[model samples]
Target: MATDFWASTHYKRWIVDRATLRQARADDLLYIDDPEHLAFLAIYFAEVVGKLGKKLRLPQRAIATATVFFRRFYLKNSYCETDPFIVIAACCYVAAKAEECPAHIKNVVSDARQIFCHEPYNIKHFPSDNSKLAEMEFYLVDDLECDLTVFHPYRTLLALCKSGNGSEDASAQEEEAGEVGAGIPADDGPRYWGTGQGQLELPPNGLQTAWFIVNDTYRSELCLLYPPHLIAIAALYLTCVFHPATHETVSAVLAASSSAPASSSASTTPDPPPRRSSRQAAERKKPAQDPLEFLAELNVSLPLIATIAQEIISMYTLWDRYKEDSGSVATPDSSRNGEDDGPVVTPALLTVVLMKMREARLLEIAHPSSGRPVAVNKMLERTQAAG
Candidate 1:
């Protein structure tokens, strides 16, 4: 397995541009009118994979790897060309082995069936034969080009946290100088980092919230569009934004720093420099650095981060409007029933779109004289055969 993500196939072969990703999905999009429908299906399947992973008792790493595999497969091929239910099972099986936490093929199939049998899915087409999953695993590996080693954002998030906390000595000095919480609103108390003293700390649930965000990224094309580290940074950024304490602390620090020069110049006669301890002197020169500051210092593309952030925000909007049984737009509350726990895209809807894709392929295959590109026709035939 490649420990360095930069040298791995994931970075070299898997990271794709948005245009390339969109072009790859052009064929599938023809069958499904709304592009957001693809996102809805992705989220629904990601959750399904998560549930199956839990049932199999696989670790988070394995589950994450499985979700990536499922997404990567779809990037190369459409749901119409393959049954996503079997693909989900295959991904779980393959990811387990790749992560060195293998699960039994039979157990994966059984667990997947149980999950598909429920509410929105009501899927009766899931293959009962464990061999089908095993067979699909071969196709999945081929589609993935055997790049089974997946580096996730979780490790990167942890590393960033540790590095952020390493600045505690400096942060403590700022706390002593009464500069740590300067300019912060009264309501924005130090809920996460402890009265703005010591190191930058995530709120009680900040790390978990970021982890969930990272998990949710798999539901979008982020895994394919950006590197794992960038995704980790984006997740951390969102975590800080969502948590008032962390967000305010960073904002206050930046706001204070930006206004420092103006405030110092406005004074007619500045007070003499105070005689103070070395710690205080150091604090005077360097204020407490929050996670946001740490993020800003990193050598990364801010635009890319902004783009990923926007993509995630867009996904949230799509998730809120997604419904299992309908293609029409509806609010989150309207989509849910009293009995249903959450919204899900039914297999029946997926089946309908997939059948259309297959029919189009069949028509293309029959009429070689049609204007459709020969390459597309052959590709469709190959996908149809693989299915």
Candidate 2:
């Protein structure tokens, strides 16, 4: 019944140290082949959700939270363990629930199946007549160890922006009255430290503001350590910086948006891109030169497709750390963000997280063949229910 992130079952298991996960990622053979592949899958998945989130006009935070969920799950598990489409929908479903978006399972699944079936990653091998979702859900739980609490960076950004407005005015009065230090924590206080040596810049604005917000939140371990608000700012900021041209517009819009009280846009967003265009997801996005390329464009790091390939190898490293810390082996560290919360580790949660992950050395493989009757519909149901 308690929901503290640190006290949650997730905190006990899913989080990992970044440096440690990196070592495994570097040394492991599976991830060595294609780390980019995996990272991009996350980016691609986020893009799909982003479009839908935007269409529905949901708060950027909700969509960002969902994307973070997708990324964390994959970071902890693998693609084949359960269908990615299902995983993505699950993230949205969970995010919707967490954010109190009220998304139903049937709608999420039916919409996701329809979108994926028509667009990129045109997966035709899904099961057509099974509660494939239950199986996959079990797998997801297994891999993630049932840990589901997720934090993001967006909340920090809002707080910073809101507080900054007040602090800025206060500081303005300080300058007029006579420069004097207020009750601010010099180290983690409300000072706008900039790139220069000692000069304080104006309160962060435009794209840079987003970056600072993200960076600070990331450092807090929110993604794995703190909360999604931290990461949301990062993603939003990164999006702005990379696409400065568009970011300029985004900043202006967001600035105005920030002024309004927080509200969840309840209207259903546009559908995900059709599955027929799966292969073409790379080509369809029109991107900016360099920065924009990596920031917004899904294929910004296409060459890193191997990251996805490395899931198998890097995963072990996570499992090893988890096994050492928790004195167990079935579940692994969900991220290197290092907040300390591990996966749920309950049989039910573990069953959902680890559904598709299997080493080549392991026996009993389903092989994801065509006409598999995937449990996509049911997956949607559970996702909504769980959320």
Candidate 3:
């Protein structure tokens, strides 16, 4: 289950200093202030996640899952941790075997240098040294409290959107809308969000996750604080207003209504606010359920989740087309059903995998049919035939 960011090391040690957060305001990095950046990072690193998975030969789902974990962690905590660069790289390491995307520490470090390296910031400090990452790993584990599982809005949102024999109705739509980006309860006491909430605004994808965090909370079915749809809308509004998402993305959604359903509601709507990302960028946008929350089941299913964790391990290998030659499962899958078990591969999971890939620009969302069921490509070589 996805936990609060405040309780994370990100909240405690990593709040991005306000000065630093704004430092790029006057430079080329001004886009850092735009919300598109959040989408940008999630998309970008998702590629890294996939590449790492391939190099290590792990599953596509595991790679996508780890990327989401890294993105969510940064949303609440400022980027002021010992070395966020290190943490980002380390997260892939921690999420690897757990998510079943295994890689040698040496290889992980090597790839980190090759792909994610920024020109000025020496990549060496970013998880290359075993000693360094080991230290940060402990910090990450401590901050996250070994709570490494993350729930993604992709599948949750997709399920909510795709239910009912491939068509949706208003009531069903409302239910799907509630699946992601619910309202965030201010933490005055338990501070489940970690020590990072009161800190500066989150990182690029921080608010994106913020949108998810709030909504996932609502999906718990334990509260009436607000409807999940309301939370999704508001969170997207807030995220688009304040962070890397620009008015462009926000307005695009609004403008899109014209070509869409042409509901009476669309005609009465006001123009969205003027915000940042490239105007052309909005025109290129594709439809995604706002806040994209579809994994509401995690809120109340820890027992089932324990089993899913094991399944994640096998799937990671199945996708990578590389695994132990010995053919033993990295972690065993449930054998109780007298059924053939495979990685946790499903259409919903595939959507998240695809969303991450599209965001990373590795693949373009040209036509709806243009998209590939990449989840299968990476994992279908599930096993070799008997010798």
Candidate topping TM-score: 1
lDDT of 2 by residue, 16-108 (tens): 566644543342223223343333233345556765555445555566556666655655544543356666666666666556564666666
Better of 2 and 3 by lDDT: 2
Residue 275's lDDT within candidate 1 is 70
CA lDDT of 338 in candidate 2?
50
TM-score of each: 0.74, 0.43, 0.33
By summed lDDT, which 10 consecutive residues of candidate 3 come out lowest? 378-387
Off by over 4 Å in 3: 1-54, 80-82, 117-124, 154-387
TM-score winner, 2 or 3: 2
Clashes of each: 0, 91, 39
Per-model root-mean-square deviation over C-alphas: 10.1, 21.9, 22.7
> What is the Cα-based TM-score of model 2?
0.43
Off by over 4 Å in 1: 163-201, 270-286, 323-387
Clashing pairs in 1: none
Ranking by lDDT: 1, 2, 3
- lDDT of candidate 3 over 125-227, digit per residue (tens): 3444565555556655655566554333333233222222222443443453332222233442222223222222222454344334333332121111222
What is the RMSD of candidate 1?
10.1
